[model samples]
Target: MSDSNTSDFTNPSSFILQGIPGLEEAHVWISIPFCTMYVIALLGNFTILFIVKREPSLHEPMYYFLCMLASTDLILSTSILPKTLSIFWFNYREIDFSACLTQMFFIHCFIAIESGIFTAMALDRYVAICYPLRHSTILTDPVVAKIGLAVVLRSGVLALPTPFLARRWPYCRTNIISHTHCEHIAVVKLACADTRLSSYYGLSVVFLVTGVDVFFITMSYAQILRAVFSLPTKEARIKTFGTCGSHLGAILAFYIPYLFSFLTHRFGHNVPLRFHILLGSVYLLVPPTLNPVIYGVRTRQIRDRLLRLLTQKGT
Candidate 1:
């Protein structure tokens, strides 16, 4: 570890994208756009939450999941964003080891929760599309609440080991994280001690937890499609697909960058340092900016409610 990196870790940071080579200089380019994205994302998602909370009709399993997701995105975005922007704009790169660990913990946890909510949402779509007649009964308040609680608990528990594991490592020289935030990989890699085992463990958790959740979400949607095709009427088919349009859009927007990041992390050194970093930044920024839009554009009920909320408030 270099002396500079070591010193940076001691006092930690306030609002900077620490640890990356040349990031202090590159902030003028990426940081500006990143800050803008954060503002728009925060505004858009909170609008959804406010509208959903104000209106009663919008309350349902699907919207509930949307609310969960919006809330998750808010938490996820705020977790690293301010500090990341601070690093860029304020030139702050110091972060306490404990603070960095907490950041990594939630970064992974909320993302995992997003995955879980998405899976539950797929199941909701399946119930609504495949068993329209039984949707009401199969997706009752109790069931939905159970799923929500389960999602939160599952994501939270999976991340419980992260801080513990991170703390056990003998931190070496520098604490300069190579990315904008305290991302799990970057934080672990900064450890002067051997991080191979810890890195593998974290990666395994990602695959087993988030990856598996995505696989099941895909499967649920596939089953939904098959059931849709079974409908004897064309109108039913359109309705079935329409019901999932927003969800599909949100899923694609959220997961594509995630998939890219996962892949690049697996094989990106062959590319450029900028490549992986850029992809991860996009992954963090894009979903929060786009999620509310997807819901507003596709889900008519939420759209109408949000539109009314905006109009009434002259926003």
Candidate 2:
């Protein structure tokens, strides 16, 4: 190993994050839009959470799941964007090794939890549409609490290994991460040691959480489609589809960019670097920014409450 890499293992102090390599000159400009997105994400999700909390009528399973989603989005965005903006705006790029691992852990853990929540939402929708009469009994408050707890614990436990494994790897190279955040692969690639097992583990985690969530969500939607088409009237079908619109939008927003980014990372070696970086940024930013908008526009309850709250504040 080179002397610098050897020293990295012996006395690693900090890792420098490269935000967007060629756009260092434009970081000030970049921060404007990124900061805007972060603000929108925060306000939008917290509004959703507030609406859920204040509205007693929205104490159903579907809205409860929505609350979980909003909370997850808020935490996820908060975890990354502040540090990201610090890097972009102030060139605050160095992160302590242990702190980097902790950030990476929360990032992956929340993502996994969000994916699990998506699956739970799917199941909730399936029961609501397929077995309407039993929906209340099936997804009672206690049950929702249990599901929420399980989702949190599952992701927390599963993602624990990521930072631990990365921490153990001897980073025998320049401690420069190629992205804004300390992503598992981004940090692990800095290590000179063989990362095959860790890399595979990362892939496995992705497939395990996202893959399973997508599979179940698809199944739920398929069953929903079948049930919708079986409705007695076209109006009934339209109404049913309308109710699912917000969720479908949220799912597409979350998964499409995510899957695209994942593909580009593994297979898009020839693709432009800007595309890879921007896609990852979009994956992180878009869902949080758009989820509340989709929910607000499509769900009458949230929209009405939000408008009332704004009106009250204005008055």
Candidate 3:
């Protein structure tokens, strides 16, 4: 090969994304459903934001936390799906190195924020269920704002390192990323350098964020269950449990697929490439798509408010 050919192979200026490698012929067909999901997620989350902003009745702690959740979901899905659709619909697969890192940073950061927000929501439920009278005083507007800020900062600071570390590592060859989006570990693996530290750091960040959030959320729900069972009447128990149903569903929608993706990617190396990519995409896409539906159907207040808003807009 000539020096130019060697140079082109060795140090390409941009990376090509594999994007479901063997499904090359199906990209357009696959993009149709994904585009639908992205649309639903955007509309759902934006409606939540709109309802929260317009309804004074929803200006309390629970809805405030929900607003945080909706906002995070919006950012998360927006960060990922647009670029993915461009790849599928436009076949524009070239992503610059800096842009790739930037995407990786936002994706991981919002994921951390998503986990943290869910944990916060669990804590909110615990407070409201286990200690109703103190709930207002405990999660007052100022306190809720502070908690929201803390969750953002915590996720941001922790996730900031992963992309930076990856960017600084040398990549002397093979600029093709093996997935649809620039996932941190996937991109890191492409680097031609010792990535043990980066790998461990990524694992640690995941465990630290998701692990702690999951632990706290589980404990909160356990306490909530205990408190519900202790209710003096079956009616009270039913009401309390009903209130928690939406949150529980949202949690399952997110964590179950998320854990499956994480485990399969990190440990299930024997898994098919398509399965890994599909699972990861599902993990990212499903929660944002379903969370609004869960909340809208289950939370009577949001459902009623949304109906009213739509009715008003219709006439």
Candidate 4:
């Protein structure tokens, strides 16, 4: 522990992260699954990016959005996993203040960006299904590029305040975070100063990003469902719905755990601290780990291309 003298307390040299309160003995055992998920997330997202980029057949708006999602997943998972593993494996738990903020920013920024991408993907599917003739014209290459840019910009700008807000507070209290990573709320709670503004801003950003995205996604799917049912044939309806299955799965994967963790942290007093921390850690891992697999298995184009590449390698 550092000195609690006024100057030292105000701006500590580094903060210690106590990974998962009450789970100290099982940190090593717990890390096995986290490490495996991280590795799979890395490989799966990279594979998605590679296949999407190399295959000309995949040079479309949907695939482009998928590539963006993959890239975001890579960033989101990478932002937290290495440090978490270090904490679990080697007990290297000290994180510099600036680096902690950086990690926090990336984690939240990309999460918002990923939610935006999911909305964009929903829009892509909606346009493709409902207005097939206009899909290309509505979402041209330049349009897709602009959407990608907007998603990144929106998330980055919204998340930019988190670290600054956190930094303004003086940490007269202890500088030990009780989780594996420097989540904004967890880090800010250590401050002796009023953190209500920071907490409100964080909550507002979550609603602005995720709440709005979810509404749009739901509306898009509603329109899509209407259009699918209007189709003349049952087979056509099923086929159209099939195209959306992967996106739906990906959305559920990302948001379900995310919302659970958020709610647990904010309101679930009865929830065990270890369970919340573990859920928080797993919340970051599960989406990235599952997204590529969902798309690869449920999406025929990606699945075929992946199989072809694997077949070639096997031969």
Question: lDDT for every model?
Answer: 0.79, 0.87, 0.87, 0.93
Candidate 2: where is the Cα deviation over 4 Å?
A: 1-8
- For model 3, what is the C-alpha lDDT against the true structure? 0.87
Lowest lDDT block of 10, candidate 3: 1-10
Q: Which candidate would rank higher by lDDT, 1 or 4? A: 4
After the best TM-score superposition of candidate 3, give how far the Cα of residue 191 lies from its true spot, in angstroms: 1.4
Estimate, for each residue in 1-315, the C-alpha lDDT of model 2 and write its tens digit: 222333546336678888887888988898888889889999999888988999899989999999999999998988889988999888998888888999999988998888888899889989989999999999999999999999999899989999989988776677777788888888888887888988999899999899888999999999999999999999999998788888889999999989989999999999877667767776888888999989999999899988898999999
lDDT of 3 by residue, 1-315 (tens): 221212334344567777887987898999998999999999999999999999998999889888888888898888889888888888888887778888889989999999999999999999999999999999988998888999999999999999889877777656777789998877877677898989999999989999999999999999999999999999989998899999999999999999989988889978999888877777888998999999999999999998998899899
Q: How do the residues 26-70 of candidate 4 rate in per-residue lDDT, one tens digit apiece?
A: 999999999999999999999999999899989999999999999
Worst 10-residue stretch by lDDT in candidate 4?
Answer: 1-10
Model 3, TM vs. native: 0.95
* Model 1 spans with C-alpha error above 4 angstroms: 1-20
Tell how far residue 200 is off in model 2, in angstroms: 0.3
RMSD vs true structure, all candidates: 2.8, 2.2, 2.3, 1.6
Q: After superposition, how far is residue 39 of candidate 1 from its true place, in Å?
A: 1.3
Candidate 4 accuracy as TM-score: 0.97
